[model samples]
Target: MDWLGLLAFGDTGWGDELLYGLGITLGLSLATFPIAILLSFLIHWAKASKHRPVRIAAHAYTTVFKTLPEILTLLILYYQSQAVVNWLTGWIVPGSSLSVSPFLAGLIALSLVISAYGSEVVRAALNAIGKGQTEAAQSLGLSPFNTFRKVILPQLWRHAIPGFGNLWVILLKDTSLVSIIALSDLVHVATLAINTTREPFFFYLVIGAIYIVLVVLSTRLQKTLEQRASKGITRMEVSDA
Candidate 1:
């Protein structure tokens, strides 16, 4: 009869259900970010290493991950997690139901997807560092680690923020795909609401509003971070003349 009635909690309404779904979506995004960053950094380094074979292997890693579609990964992980678990341990873990935890399955899927894309962003960022900077740091007798920490990483962020920021927004929207496996993110919650209340249009509209708000806020926050990262560089421009 009313919107709130439709969304109400405690088996009376669906509002609590939607909210819980949103929480899961947010958690999935956040949990993957750190892992993505770590993986990206390591793979980027391997790609950039002086050893030819190492670079080739890194290239293969990035290429494969980047090319593999996320849904494919999700299906594989969803079906295989139990097998993986069983293979690792001779005896079955008492409660490790791989197919049941859609949340974890979605995490693995989106993480692989975002991490592959993030690695490319990181690789380009590393490449943007001028050779002179590294050479100068070496001349100053700074260790490679210190040089990377102090000089290279800062500049790398400045160059990489544009791509990485865009990816963050893209991945935020992409989280909806997890609904297929039934982790019950915003899309699935809205779908349920519409079907239950016979207000398909209204529920969809509400879901759209939620998505718009989240994406807009995220975009603004990313812009602020990018501005901070590029503060020094933005003030000056290189003249090709």
Candidate 2:
């Protein structure tokens, strides 16, 4: 079958399966992103804390995750988490076994890796916020929380945008790694299609094309966000004339 026909719908083609796989891929990324962002901020704050224990713990978290290979992290978390779940199930309800969903497992694994890097981004952004601003806000009778919400966060976001955008692209591509655990993600589905259709080149190429499109769109979206975030900030320009 031609590439177009192979990707066409209506019972004979693998189009539906691929579409479903795409949905799962997007869902996983979307679910992981917000969790990663929240964790990044928390980690950044912990690392910045005056208490030695908090800083030590936060540093250890980032050091461990950033040092480990993502695939290894995923494998360890997936199997270890399942082992814990199984142990609990055996004790709680004899003869009944429970398992972690691949979706949730993949999310947890990816979030750990992404947020490790994101923490650095957040830390840099927070540092970029001048100490004077905090003092100024406090002088205006604003509480720490209000100062962060109104004054610190806005500037931090602008500085963080570029780093977050880069991480977003990496995270999107990293979703393919979930295919290793038989999650039926885009790459996994493509592999199945290739085996069934006996057209490895075509199916793999299709997967590549889909990923390229996603990267392009993500990059464009990132640029849009940077522009929006940097609104009212001065930008340097070179004169051609």
Candidate 3:
């Protein structure tokens, strides 16, 4: 079969399998993103709290996750979480068996690492907001929640866009790690195809191309979001006149 024919969607080729694996890669990354964002915000809030213990606990959360290797964390969560869950289920309902789906385990593990890094970005964004902005909102009779939503979040997002863009690109590539647990993501299927066809060069090159395409598209989307967030904000450009 010719090189092109090998990528054909007909029964003679592996296109369908590759497409399905790509779908899983995209789905997993998208599903994990919002969870990571929420987790980061919660961690940042804890760190920002007036309570001393809350701040300490939040720091510890980021410290431990950020210090550990991501793959090791995933491996532990993938295997150990099931045992932990089954133990609880056994006590709650006799003979009940509980299992953590590989997808869920991967998502949780990725989110932990992502959120640990993301929390710093969020905290930095929060700190970038001027204290006078909050005071102004209060003087205008806006409640604390209203001040956060209206006066703070918009500016926070503007500062956060660049950091988040980097995180997202990293997250997309990181989804390939799920293949280690046999999730059949893009890299996994490409490896399977190579094994069957004995065309490792062609298949692996295809995998690299797919990743490049994803990152290129993501970068474009990130630029658009950055522009939208920066709308009406003025910057002083210094040039040799």
- Cand. 1 TM to true fold: 0.86
Pull out the clashing pairs in model 3. Answer: none
- Give me the runs in candidate 2 sitting further than 4 Å from their true place: 234-241
Candidate 3 Cα errors over 4 Å, as ranges: 235-241
Per-residue CA lDDT of candidate 2, range 25-118, in tens?
9999999998999999999889989999999999999999999999899899999999999999999999888999888999999999999999
lDDT of 3 by residue, 1-241 (tens): 4878778896888899999999999999999999999999999999989999999999999999999988889999999999999999999999998989888999999999999999999988888887899999999999999999999998999999888889988999998888899998999999888888899899899989999999999999999998877765744223322
TM-score of every candidate relative to the true structure:
0.86, 0.93, 0.93
Error of 3 at 100 (Å): 1.2
lDDT for every model?
A: 0.79, 0.91, 0.91
Once model 1 is optimally superposed onto the true structure by TM-score, how far is the C-alpha of residue 176 displaced, in angstroms?
Answer: 1.5
Clashes of 3: 0
- Which residue pairs overlap in candidate 1's backbone? 7-14, 7-15, 8-13
Q: How far is candidate 2 from the true structure (C-alpha RMSD, Å)?
A: 3.1
